[model samples]
Target: MNTNPFKFGTVVDDEFFTNRKEEIGKIHSILSSENHLILISPRRYGKTSLISKAIKALERPYIFLDLQLITNIEDFTSQLLQKTLKYYPFEKIKHFFKSFRIIPNISLNPLSNEVDFSFNPTMSSSVILEDALNLIEKLSTKEKKIVVIFDEFQEINKIDKNLDKKLRAILQHHKMVNYVMLGSQESLMKEIFEKKKSPFYHFGYLMQLDKIPYEEFFDFLTERFEKIKNNGSGLSKEILEFTKLHPYYTQQLAFNVWENLIKNNSEDIKEVILNSVITHDNDYERLWGLLNKTEMKIIIALAYERKSPLTDEIRTKYMLGASSTVFSSLKKLIQNGFVVKINSSYEIEDPFFKEWLLMRRAN
Candidate 1:
């Protein structure tokens, strides 16, 4: 084959997307109804891919944006309006701008002929944000509820301190649009919608995503790997075992394995993993540089097979300092997303990063 079958590092769809049948069905149902949805999960669990696939399947007119890439309120308003413009011709939507409290400056992309919308920096962001959101509701057809997706929705507060109050005030009355708020940061997302003091408390149905099940993921790997040369030798099982069914890492490891197999006709799984670790060494190093002394100690201790980081034996062995310091480091790591608490124990979120740390410690 000229191209690899396994895909990662981007939104997966069509044949590349896998193991979200139930999720897609639920999302489709949610979008079909009047209620909005708040979907939460850690990073790289294929949240965007799942949402995109469902929206595509819905066949409804939609507008999409990722809040992570958005800078502030004006940017939010302009980008939201820009995506909406793609669904409507300039002439059809030109009149809507007149209703905005602060009308955006509009231009046209010469090649795509698509409209480009921008708001004046001097204008009030809240006014523009409210207007842009209302514009989406106005554009919604009575027969169809336009689906508006906000990826990394937890960052909404960074755009404005009172963004939640303003946004919920407008969204609560929106009957013609279904909103999907995708958040990778679970704690912040929960705080926004679960806290009684929050304006958006109980605003939408909350759904949490987990890693794809092992049985299904193993089957997918086997089926895809079979198309390659000499791949039925339990390598798929080994790959799934290595990634533990993390959708992103599973696809990434499978992609690397396929690349090695196709290029060198080699089935050395260990070699592939080492090379994969080496491939991402610089990235991992950058992440490593961000750690403080205590964080560095805690992560290394975790990588060293210190199952329970706070145990007296483990802490003494690693010289992890005072109990409060170790506890604070662990909390920071979890909040920054370097670590996660599963069941009862804490573990590093990145498999390759853990391996990379181990490799460097050995060297």
Candidate 2:
């Protein structure tokens, strides 16, 4: 049986999971303590997988709730309670949840044999939230501490402005549960945890997941590619070189390259890049139609090896108009996750978008 050695577009785990030894170690160590964790990474950079790996290594019962799926405060409480029911026995926690002032409406999914929870929407949200959160402490024994992971936690404020204050107040008093909160949006996560006025400020140990170092990523790709072809390491370097070790795009490009090698018996990345561009052509077209003219100019300039888009040289060459206008456009791009601010330079978040821009210009 042959399966593609490279994978992307989902949580890469086990063999497909790339190198994040230090990160996993840090997360695992924090999970072992009473302190909570706040992990921030750009979308698809493998923060979820890192947390999954750490929890598996720790060999503890865990509950995962993605706040992105949460529609409101009631849904948040129900989702957390649902995952809790799956991890802990119903009978053990039945009395605890049943005693709530407003009892949760529980049902069993016959196909999956998992429980679902819902509460009366008419009840106060904060009280419902407190009851759901208390399940963490109730289910834990002295020896076995549970891990509750919240992914895309930046959505808390959107559910209700003061939900953060309420959640922080409840979570601070828990003794038997260790929380690991993960968020994708850099700016929002920063504001929620880094700002002085935010209730969640400094509530946990902060960590930012970064691009996999080139040295480690290069070796990872080379090892897998070599098994598929002789001296595949040389060819594999092109994937990293083109991706610049961006975690998600590196896997995406490698997936396409692996497909090219299997079907066409070639290591050439050029054809793969072109085919990828063609595959996403319509999406790029729509994106281009939506982008502001100033943004279009900046993207072109960056694609042309012109770094520091704010600089006078780039502004002059790209006809980017006033510096402040360029700054405002770039900020918009960054806020929308289209552009990433790296140190003193700015880069398009999607590597394929950058390639498509350059390719369109060439034609």
Worst 10 residues of 1 by lDDT: 224-233
Lowest lDDT sum, 10 consecutive residues, model 2, at: 335-344
Where does candidate 1 clash, by residue pair? none
Runs off by more than 4 Å, candidate 2: none
RMSD of each: 2.1, 1.7
Report lDDT (CA) for all predictions: 0.85, 0.85
In lDDT terms, how accurate is model 1?
0.85
- Report the CA-based lDDT of candidate 2 relative to the real structure: 0.85
Residue 113's lDDT in candidate 2:
83
Model 2 per-residue lDDT tens digits across residues 1-363: 457878888887888987689998898788778889999877777888888888888888888988888788898888888877766778777888666877878888899888877777588989888988887778886677888898999888888878899999999899899888899888889999999998888989999888898888888888888777888778768787788788889988988888888888987898898889899999999988888889888888878864687888889988999999999998888777788876657888888888999888888
Best prediction by TM-score: 2
Model 2: which residue pairs collide?
A: none
